[model samples]
Target: MSGRFQAAAPKAPSTLEKITKSPLFTVGLNTAYFVAGIAFIQSPLMEMLVPQL
Candidate 1:
């Protein structure tokens, strides 16, 4: 009975490598996500409070 658990090696990077390499890209992504999230949260409340015209 000789069974040992071995950890797998880490995988290599793919296309996402460029985003991680640039600070501007990350900032832009964060900003877009923030704006989108705000819009998402507001849309439902707006529809509920405002009558359809």
Candidate 2:
């Protein structure tokens, strides 16, 4: 009888997890990353910081 117990329900996602899963949040995060990458690639700081491979 003890082995017949049902499995527990999954825990709910946290607020941060919910926010990050939203479409708008995903787009905004991707846009920010893209812009930062472009800025870093265009700036001279990239040359100073990274060695040519």
Q: Write the per-residue lDDT of candidate 2 for residues 1-53, one digit (tens) a residue.
A: 77787989999999999998899998999999999999999999988999778
What is candidate 1's CA lDDT for residue 34? 100
Q: Which ten residues in a row have the lowest lDDT in candidate 1?
A: 12-21
Listed in order, each prediction's TM-score against the native is: 0.46, 0.64
Over the stretch 1-53, how does candidate 1's per-residue lDDT look in tens digits?
Answer: 35977779998777689667789888988999999989977887767877779
Return the clash pairs for model 2, or none. none
Q: How accurate locally, in lDDT, is each candidate? A: 0.84, 0.94
Q: Total backbone clashes of model 1? A: 0
Q: Report the CA-based lDDT of candidate 2 relative to the real structure.
A: 0.94
lDDT of 1 at 46: 65
Lowest-sum lDDT 10-residue window in model 2: 1-10
**Superposed Cα RMSD, model 1:** 6.1
